[model samples]
Target: MASTSRLLFASSFSHPSLSITTGSDATRDLWLKNRKVPKEHCSKISMQHNWKHSYKCIDGGSTRDKSRGKFYINATSSQSHESQPQSFWKSTKDIMHTLQKFVMSYYLITMLMSIISSSLLAVENLSDISPKFFVGLLKFIIPITFMYFYAVGINQVTDLEIDKINKPYRPLASGKISYKTGVIFTISCSVMSFGLAWMTRSKPLLWCLILYFAAITCYSINLPLLRWKKSTILTLISNIPSMLLTSNVAPFLHMKTYVLKKTTIFPRPIVFTIAVMSFYYLVIMLLKDIPDIEGDKAAGLQTLSVRLGPKRVFWLCVSLLEMAYGIAVIMGATSPFLWSKFFTVLAHSIMAFVFYYRANSVDPEIKDVSQSFYMFIFQMMT
Candidate 1:
């Protein structure tokens, strides 16, 4: 995780406190000269009793050490030895650290979660809390919390290459979290995510879980393998679950609850607003990838902006609000006088787009700055 974090930092290491590879030719050539296929080389090493080994990060990323023991670049891929030592406190601390790193680094996940939580709180706008919103919170938190952890593990597994090049500081990539350890944490999160969602016993929860699985699988692995990271439609759609999850539970929690004559929970206009709000988040996320374009390209990642050219994507990002607002006004006008919904929708749309456009200068730091601005504005706007 440290290595990956360092790589992430190094991916855009313009900061004075950090040092990372610039993906230069001298480095590549050095790696090639010293390179040996990890699998073939590691299989020959003996993994005996407990002993610590170290690898030096030479200019070419080749391992050398005074001990001269074999080093594994991706130990997870070639895990040998009986098993890693077990300790109750060690395990607990490890998982906690992983979760913390994930939350701290990915502002989008945190922001979306905040929005969802706040929106659900908004559902209480007109009334005190009840079973419906109680259920809604259950529906909202479990799926997302689980997905966040799951995403961290899966993203780490897939991003080993880029991490190696740019972020060699993350714990996992840096040998802080071993392959066995990472797998354990990933599985733990996945199982917990499913179990927690199942506990909710809500249709929305189940559907969201399914959607989350599909999105990660499709975007993180399948589509990338197919090299379709570009194409505005596909890239944008892959992020729907995240957007929807953030907005899904809010409307049901609204203050004005119309009880059907039959006494079952009735539909509210709040639901559509959640969807509209989520769309706004998705647009910013799209713009957030700008800095990563170069690193992603070097790593063979073809995200939408990377494929379409960042400038086009930037303008396209600016246009999304017009498109979204147009859709919202058309649909709302055709319907009833849900004036509150329209204004809320318009307000969030403008706020999200305006902040996102201003924040879309460059990626990495600029994106972080943009995200910070967006979060601040979103809080104020909401």
Candidate 2:
């Protein structure tokens, strides 16, 4: 019966006028008209696809599919495959972009350099530090990155209105991300930072991380009792601790994990570096508000630039930075090492000039100029 059915179906397919329909009913009708097999013994056939000269069928309860015109065979099991790795990499790229937006990628270098320089200065012996420093640096990066992302993410969430004027194109302000998602991401980052820090089991690191986080909390949150960012002086004072810890102290603590004793919290070089950075940070923070004067005024936040005017603020920033560079240059020139003086004087003199040139050329109302100089500050630090 099967042989007779196959021959009849083959003869019908050869006929030009007979159109084969790709449907179960069509298959059943054709099978019933040509074959005399009992319904119980004759398995149902499904026509999957149709072409000009071909069709494919899979019989019920059968593990194989047969094609007539262009016979194709599958020797492997009928498991489906997909491009999982490609999808995974695409998701990874998206995550990295979001992370960069959250943490401000340009500022990451400043943090990294802080760790490197602090580690170098923390140890009395320079020759002793080697590739191990970098290995340790890599490990320290995970927690620090999470902490920074959390801090900035919270700031973005709280300062959305101000950012709309100052940085409308930002991910949160521009509506690229929803506020709920931003809050969740920030909270996750906070948890990850603390979890990673706890895993390290270093007393100094845990202590420093706690202090940094406390300062960040006060700087960003709008709690009625602790709106630290509202006042310029309070903002500067609050941010100073986190800045010093992240840049100069965190690296030192990480590097000296095994050798840390009851020494002073701030080393000599760290104190000087933090002083310079505090002044630099204060200038940039003020300049940051210059472009947002309209928004700040609308929000009733009394930033320095709003009170002083942009031109005056611009010059103030330039002058303060110049003084910092001048002091650094003097320190280098007066150092016992002649090479230190030569390099410091040359590098700082060039930086001072560049700062002047750039600041002079800047249009005070333009936020992009402020951002450009902000990046330039890190470039010089590097």
Candidate 3:
């Protein structure tokens, strides 16, 4: 009987849920009395060992089968551990999705345009390609990137309802990001952009940012006697200046006056670029509305697409872009440099042909087709 009691105690002590505590002889005697273990066996056991033990439930709570002397660990803890990484990845995916909606392809295109325009101007100014040029270019790009995001964000915030109808997948429209969050994001971007431009101490860059901000404000903000986008003429007025600033004039002046440390002058290439881009941007401005005609009409926004039928506006935009390409081809053909002449003429001719092909294939009545063509136009600009 003593041997059987000792074996029982050993097994109980070795159980996962049981913990042992060492104690004095009196405490061991008390434990032996309570457990009814034989005194002989208790005496044989080491005096330093105390049989007093307690069962501990693993975290997240546990259940024990007293009849079977079994403990079941809670699955909640293991499940939580497994879900942590998944939860983190899900959150990351959500953030990226929201960013994609906020900073669409157009904003990226804007940044690319700014970088290309600035880099070209830098190349013209500097005798050698150096780190300083890249550094300055980066500085310019940082502010422009923030500003472009701000422009798109603010527009989305203001046009949330319209986007719901026209672009349901957008963050604001889809409820991925709240209106208040979008407003805060745009405000933050605007502050960062202005702060960076101010820190640069470049008057041209500062002015350019300011002008772009004002143009977008007039184009988007719904104030009394404002909202330039409501009227086609007012929309063009706002867009033309913004386009010139974004694609040509502002970048050129900023690079000349700030990065190159030279007097501002519009060279022949700058003027030609401005003219070409102006025409291209004009086409974009008109074409972009075609896909959003349904929403615009519902919102009582008389865009060219809403006023004049989508077909007419579509053809007009195509014709205008074709004209711009034709002019570009002529300009390229007349270039003084043989290489420039050959490449420019060849590139424009090919682009013009591709644009014609793509335009003919698009059915403006289909929103997806019109939207694809709109993106195609932006791709051509880049």
Candidate 4:
């Protein structure tokens, strides 16, 4: 009877159809050793050696089975790494969209064009283009880009609440980026602008960038004593210098020494350019507030549009731009070059007409018309 019971127990231990319980470390170790599982599966199998967590070695193949408190990784899934490029491109597009909202790429393009035009015009001869001219032009690009980024970033950081009302879709106001990130980016850009300007070894250019930075800061920052944007006159006074520097004076200063080998004496074209831009920008500033009248009023900012109403502000902006075009026509007609007269007169006249008609057709509630007109002004400058 004892021998018969012993044989039955031994057979039960070797039975293939029976399910083995891995309740202890000894059983788990015994099962692993008896199966002689591959090294890859051994590591994952060994991790589940706990009283509650159970694992099974599926009999069909070398694949390990995952259960409660246990894990398994498929080698075939490594092919998912192939999707990395697509993931990378999607991330890149998202970043670019964010940057567009933060920095206003359309405005940046126009600013770049204005800077390049002013630089080229400062040269007395078109034939003066050379390697050095290109090199100097290239050098100006970094400082310009950094300064504008700093300006926009800092403004967005400071005006988060205002932007929630005025421009809710913006990266900062929409919570796409944190306020701390915006401040850090702004500070870095500002520092880089100055550092790159210093690298150019031009004290005058550096001073111009400094002044521009100051103007932007004064216009955007709500300092107790220096909140220039709260008043129309102060806003215009603060922003004009920045516009002039980015559009005319700084570029002229940069190129004059390189292309002309001489100091600029306020050439006629440059003078006219600054005058037209200054007046146009003043109009733009006023018109810009027209779309934000509600926010400005609620915030007690006292902008021109809050005082004058959108329709009046719209017409006023159109009239001012027309006046600028008229001046351009006069300057064009008197120019020594026939091509200059023809192009300037024709372009300005068309733009003036476009502004008048477009501004009249726009709905007061939406900013499309006013903002488009603003872009149009910069387009002409370019």
Candidate 5:
């Protein structure tokens, strides 16, 4: 009976007009009419047809049809498999976009500055620049990088609306990354930062991370009385000390205590670098707002640019930076080492002139112009 049923089923495909129906009754009728099969066998064929139909539904693929004599593949399964790489690529792109817009340059600049400062101040001999030195530097930088991301991520999360106005290309602002994802990313970064800092068992590094975390929290978090970024005075207070610590003092102390196994001492270069960075960060805090005046105004954020107008604030920042450069020149000239004096004086002089030229070229009335200048300032920092 089974052999006969199989022969009948194969022969059914010979009739091009024969339609396969999912209904058991239709299938049984067709089989009986076409194959002249016995009544008892027809029930088995009908049951087979129903089972095939159920299997097709469950498998998400089409069953063989008599008319076409072809099996249909599972389209949904194939499409999902094909899209896995594309979905992964898109997610990766979104993450890169977020980093570039939010913290990529800042992270790179911070790491570069920290490494340079620490190496200059801590490394005294050729033996100091070894594999272990680099490994220790990596350990120090990893936690700091995580904290930097945390700080920027929290700011982006809190300033979503403002960023939509000022930085729409950002992941959170453009809706490429959900707010929940941003919050999760920030939390993860903070956790990883603290965890790594704890693992190092370095008090200076741990305290620096704590201070940075607190500073960013106060600057960005929109609690009832927080969000220091909305006020100029509070913004300066929160930013300057954090920048000074992170840029100069923290790295020096971490290297001296953690890597070099030496007592902490601020050399003339370290102190001078701190002073220069303090002034530079002050200018940065004010200059950064110049391009975002519109967004700040819309958000009711009383930034220097929003309070004093962009043109006035622009000149103010440039003048402050110029004065800082002048101070650097004087300090460099007075340095006891000839090479130090020559390098610092010449570099600052050249940079000051270049900064003046760039500042003169920027028109505060143009948004893109001001924004480009803001980025240029970051380049200068690097």
Candidate 6:
């Protein structure tokens, strides 16, 4: 009831007597904050992103999606409608479209399937995989949705540096969207992420969202702190908790008693999966550092490449990826059942190395190879 009241009171369309143009910038920003946040309906992700953008007075719009981006404006029947980036009226109407674009671009549904399915199959090896679409949708949405907003917020916030250097076309830094608007929208999306997750009642998914949000927060901090080394480990290490929680606990979590005790559902395999996925995810995360070395150095990021020099980072990526291969070999040699999966993992691990290795000399090419390798690995998991 409070949320409904706040929404009604905060809405400009509800009272055409209120002129948006007459409002002060502070008033406008506040209204927007209220419209979005609205007496704390902002939910879980709100806190994660709000800290970065609430007071931000930085620089950057909306053309299309987009693959991400931000926009702001109030709506009404008058000039507010006509003057909005589109019609102010459409601004409100288009929100659904904006959300749709966000969901589609991030492949939210598919991603939920990626982790949840893999965990289900690998653990239960379930022959009858009749996924509850609603549940799958919830699980699928947890990670990708969080990632999509965080990426936008992080890009917008951190874009201050990138714009002055290379990307002057970004929304926040380029002036397409105000720092405040971008931040608010990002927070709203984050809130929506958790709000919707809660609706699904999937504790594992909720925990994954919380942890992933934290990792991204850490990513933003690392960018400024020059904890490049720690960031590398974090990029990979953080996934450990999620891997254990989701893959191990989720499937077997007697959806009945699941409500009673979620944490006590631990098993040894989860610990092992946690360590393995962390190592693999870490390798992928660090692979990105190689290409960004120069930009990182210039921005004072002190990334692994800048800290260890480019050659060392390259060898390190190779060495780390190869270690995955070695581990696979050992699994195959010993546990035949695990080895079967190991073969699948080993092939992709080596392929990831080949992609990284071939692109070692070039920077831009690295992301494509790495992404392709990610796709390859995901396919194997499927």
Q: Per-model C-alpha lDDT, please?
A: 0.53, 0.71, 0.76, 0.74, 0.77, 0.49
Error of 5 at 291 (Å): 1.0
lDDT of model 2 at position 83: 59
Q: How well does each candidate superpose onto the true structure, as a TM-score?
A: 0.55, 0.73, 0.79, 0.77, 0.77, 0.54
lDDT tens string, model 1, 1-382? 4533443333242212212324444553444345442432332222221135322333122233324634323333123232444455678887888656643454444445554554444443445456764555555566666666776677776666666654566766777767777668777887888887677555555666677766765655544343224444666676655555534442233222321112224344455555566656666667656645656778766677677776676666556755666666556555666775677567656765665666465343454443454454345424
Runs with alpha carbons beyond 4 Å of true place in candidate 5: 1-103
The clash count for each model shown is 22, 0, 0, 0, 0, 9
Highest TM-score scorer = 3
> Model 6's lDDT to the true fold?
0.49
Model 4 C-alpha lDDT per residue in residues 108-148, reported as the tens digit of each score: 88678788888888667767787888888878877988999
Q: After the best TM-score superposition of candidate 3, give how far the Cα of residue 305 lies from its true spot, in angstroms.
A: 1.3
**Each model's Cα RMSD:** 18.2, 7.8, 10.5, 9.9, 8.4, 19.6
Candidate 3 per-residue C-alpha lDDT over 1-382 given as tens digits, one digit per residue, 9 for 90 to 100: 6635444544343323222335565765674565455654453333223233442212123433323445444465567799999999999998987887777757476556655774575456346357766677777778978898888998899999999999898888999888898899999999999999899987777887898999999899999978889999999999888767765676667667677777666666776787788888788888889999999988999988888899999999989988998998898888899998899899988998999999899899899999889988877877
- What lDDT is obtained when candidate 2 is compared to the true structure? 0.71
Select the stronger candidate by lDDT from 1 and 5: 5
Candidate 4's C-alpha runs over 4 A off are 1-76, 83-89, 258-260
In model 3, what is the error at residue 241, expressed in angstroms? 1.3
Q: By TM-score, how accurate is candidate 6?
A: 0.54
Give the clash count for model 3: 0
Q: What is the clash tally of candidate 2?
A: 0
Worst 10 residues of 6 by lDDT: 57-66
Cα lDDT over the full model 1: 0.53
lDDT for residue 276 in candidate 6, whole number 0-100: 54
Positional deviation of residue 188's Cα in model 1 after best superposition, in angstroms: 1.3
Where model 2 places Cα greater than 4 Å from the true spot, the runs are 1-92, 130-135, 257-268
